[model samples]
Target: MLEISIKPEVLGYIGAFPLTNAQLTSWLSSLLLIVVAIVVGVNYKKLPSGLQSIIEMVYEFFQSMAEDAMGAFGRRFVPLAMTFFLFIVVSNWLGVVPGVGSLVSIHDPAKAVSAGIIPFGAPAVMAEAPPSADATVEEQHAYVPVFRGGNADLNTTLALAIIAQVIIHAMGIRTAGLAHHLAHFKNPLEIVTELSKILTFGFRLFGNVFAGEVLLTVMGSLVVVLTGKLAPALPFGLVGGAIAIPFVMLELFVGAIQALVFAMLVLSFLSLFVKTDQSASHH
Candidate 1:
């Protein structure tokens, strides 16, 4: 069965909190970043080269943008901006990678129900169950993917948005003084505008990533169905894969763009409030 879950599938739990696949992906992305940062830090060089060069190039590009928007003060924020972009881009790209979603673990329906992983009413799924598995056996086993897109889950995106907004507002208060920053919020329109940014930041990323996941899922499934019907014995996997190549490439580009957009939005908001202080200082 083809399962398209809007909510992330639960992988396990930490005390009372259920750990979803999206959370797992985010943790993986964070770990990868930490490892890379450590490697680059340990191998520090006077003149940039290889991975260091690539990292320098991207960091410098973002730093320039930050400085352009908020003057020298913006340089201090490039780290935060870079963190947002790097984490999101990696999470997005990982979603499109083979085996991220392709790999799965089979669960016996009875066991899954007892384990509280799935409801008895839910249809069983199989990523690639073995042949010779009887109908009775098939009904007993189900697929629970080991990985899923991080941003495809709303909880992750909303958390990002909330964090960005909180930091942005905190920066504003710190830079402009609490009285000055709160004065701006006195305007009902201003308050509404500030609140609306959370929705914009969260939903925009969530919608794009979730839509991409669904598109790839549906496209791959359609290709399989068509190939199987049009040419029996023609490996549907090969045909489906070939058809998905272009979309996957497009998703890679889209993922990068979305990440950049998110980072820029955060910086833009930061500048919006921080600039008030800078303007006052200039006068």
Candidate 2:
């Protein structure tokens, strides 16, 4: 398993509030996406090439998927839905990158490389640490990165879930009305009963994405341990990379599927709320 510690302060403040790793990751992801988008947009043309073509293909596929899920009317929400999907898919795949497990840091500089012990009077300074350390080698404190896949982090998935659900509510209200939307909770005997189901929508998405991360983690560990001792040839970089190719592709598909599932669930839930509101109106 990859374990990285990140100083909370490294991420900039959000109106005097420091962001969490997951939040920082989200910010970084957004920034990187913007840069990439600008690069692609600058070169966009009638006959797209390289990154532009890849991006266009992804957009088109999601456009089709959104339409299929929400029908012709769904196309209006395509921009928001597709953007969320692509962002999630990219972040999910980032977890499997080679350095994800290897990136780490040292909290102390001198202690990181001292002769089995830091001098009592050593000055305190931040020092770089290796991602992995050798047992025989002393004083090399191993470091792990603070950031993991945004999707792998429960906070990120949950935030996304909440945002998605909120969007659904907003869309529903716009289509229906505020009185109808709010009435979803009011008519129920107890607010607790109504609120309980609120968690279900978010939790389902969280569970699916979280489960994917767990499965990938377990499978990756097995691959490393099994290949290390049993088959040297199998562990060769090219062979290992080939073996991993399938999983990477699988992640790609899962990313898109999960995004679709999340969005579809949102639409379905909104439809239910619309119905509930309409029913209350009649009664």
Best by TM-score: 1
Q: Candidate 2's residue-wise lDDT over 1-283, tens digit each?
A: 2222222223223443444445555666777789989999887799999999998887776567655555555566667766776677666666556654323344554544441222234343333232345312223343324455666565666677667666777786886689867777675664564354456645664565556655554454455556454332334435556656677668767866776666556555544544343345545
Candidate 1: 10-residue stretch with minimal lDDT: 131-140
Query: What is the RMSD of candidate 2?
Result: 8.7
> RMSD to the native, candidate 1?
7.9
Model 1 TM-score is 0.84
User: Candidate 1 lDDT, tens digit per residue, 1-283?
Assistant: 2468788766554544566678888898899899999999999999988989989998999999998788788999999999999999999999998977765554666654443243444354443433343422223235566789889999999999999999999998898889878888786999899899999999999999999988887676675455444332246657677778889998999999999999999998898888554556776
Find the candidate with the highest lDDT and give its number. 1
Residue 55 CA displacement from its true place in model 1, Å: 0.8
